[model samples]
Target: VFFHNALPFVGFGFLDNAIMIAAGTQIELSIGVVLGISTMAAAALGNLVSDLAGLGLAGYVEALASRLGLSIPDLTPKQADMWQTRLSAHLGKAIGVTIGCILGMFPLLFFGDEEEKLEEKN
Candidate 1:
C-alpha cells in the first residue's frame, strides 16, 4: 500500500521540481531581466507552468507507475479502510515526494546565476 502511493508521487515530485527549476532559471535570465521582474516572480511563473504540466501529465505518470508493476495490494475492503493502512499510504507519499524533489534539484547544479555574471561584468 505504501509503495503503491509512494512510487507514483515520486515521479510527480521529480517532474514538478525539475520543470519548475528549469523554467524559472530560464525566465529569470530572460523575461525577468527584460521586464524587470523579480526572481521570485519568475519562480512563481515557473510554478504555474509546472502545475499546468502536471495536470496534463498525471495520466502518463500513473501509467508509468503501472508499468513498473506496482499494483494495489490485495486487501479486503475492511483492511483497506483501516486507519493504519491510510496512515502508511500517506507517510509513503510524503517521504517519496521529498526524496524525489531532492533528486530533482539536480537542475540547480547545471544553472549558474545570470545576475551574478552581469554584476561581475560591471
Candidate 2:
C-alpha cells in the first residue's frame, strides 16, 4: 500500500520519457501506458492528459501575459476550456505529453508528504 502511493511519481516519469523515447514512438503508444499501446487507435485510447496539461499551462501563460500586459482572448471559464482543447490538440502528443509530464512531477517535489524521510528516522 505504501508503494502504491508512489505510483504517481513513477507515472510522471514515464510521461516525460517521451522526449527520450524518440518522437516517432509517441504515436505508437498511448500517453499513460509504459509498455506502449500496441493498438492502432492509441491516441483515441489515451487519457485526457492533454487537456489537463493545457489547463495547467494556460493558467501560467495567462498570469505571465497579464503581467506583461498581453491580452488573452478567452479569460472566461467556458471559453478557456475550449481554448485548452484547441491548444492541446494543436500541440500534438509528442510535445504536449513531454511538457505535461514534467509539469505534473514538479508539484510532487514541493508538495508531497515526505513519508519516506519520517520512516528513516525511526
Candidate 3:
C-alpha cells in the first residue's frame, strides 16, 4: 500500500527530471513534446512495475502464512468487498500518477514548489 501511494511521487520526480533536461537543452517545441510523451510513458511503466512488485510481495506473504499452518480468518463477504475497495483505491492512485505526469509536463499545468510546500504542510 505504501509502495502504491509512493508511485505517483516517484513519477513526479521523473517528470521533473525530464523537464529540467528539456529546459537545459532548449529543445525545439516538437522535441519537447516528444520528451514529455516519453517521460509520461516511463512514469506509467514505473508505476506498473511497482504495482506488480506489491502483488508479488502480497502473494509471498500469503504463501509463507500457509506454509506455516497459520489459521487465517476467513473474511466475510462484506469484509472481502471492503478489502477490494481499498485495493482499488490504491490502484486508482497509480493510474492517477500516470495521467498526472502527462498533464504536468505542459507549461502552466505543473504544480509550482509553493503549491507542493503547502500540500506538504497540510
- Backbone clashes, each candidate: 0, 0, 0
Better of 1 and 2 by TM-score: 1
Instruction: Report the C-alpha lDDT of model 3 over 1-122, residue by residue, as the tens digit.
Output: 33444344444534544454344233323343465545355445545554555455545544554565645446576874687656865675666556645654564344355346644754
User: Once model 2 is optimally superposed onto the true structure by TM-score, how far is the C-alpha of residue 5 displaced, in angstroms?
Assistant: 40
User: Candidate 2's error at 114, in angstroms?
Assistant: 39
TM-score of each: 0.93, 0.27, 0.25
**Local accuracy of candidate 1 as per-residue lDDT tens digits, 1-122:** 89999998999999999999999988988898789888899999999999999999889999999998988799999999999999999999998899889888889888867657955864
Expressed as tens digits, the lDDT of each residue in 1-122 for candidate 2 is 11222233334444433332332234433242455455334433333444454445555643543565544344466754686655644454445445546654443443234335433643
Report lDDT per candidate: 0.90, 0.41, 0.49
- Runs off by more than 4 Å, candidate 2: 1-40, 45-47, 71-122
lDDT top scorer: 1
Candidates 1 and 3 compared by TM-score, better number: 1
Root-mean-square deviation (CA) per prediction: 1.4, 16.2, 12.5
Model 3, global lDDT: 0.49
What are the runs in model 3 whose C-alpha is more than 4 Å off?
1-81, 107-122
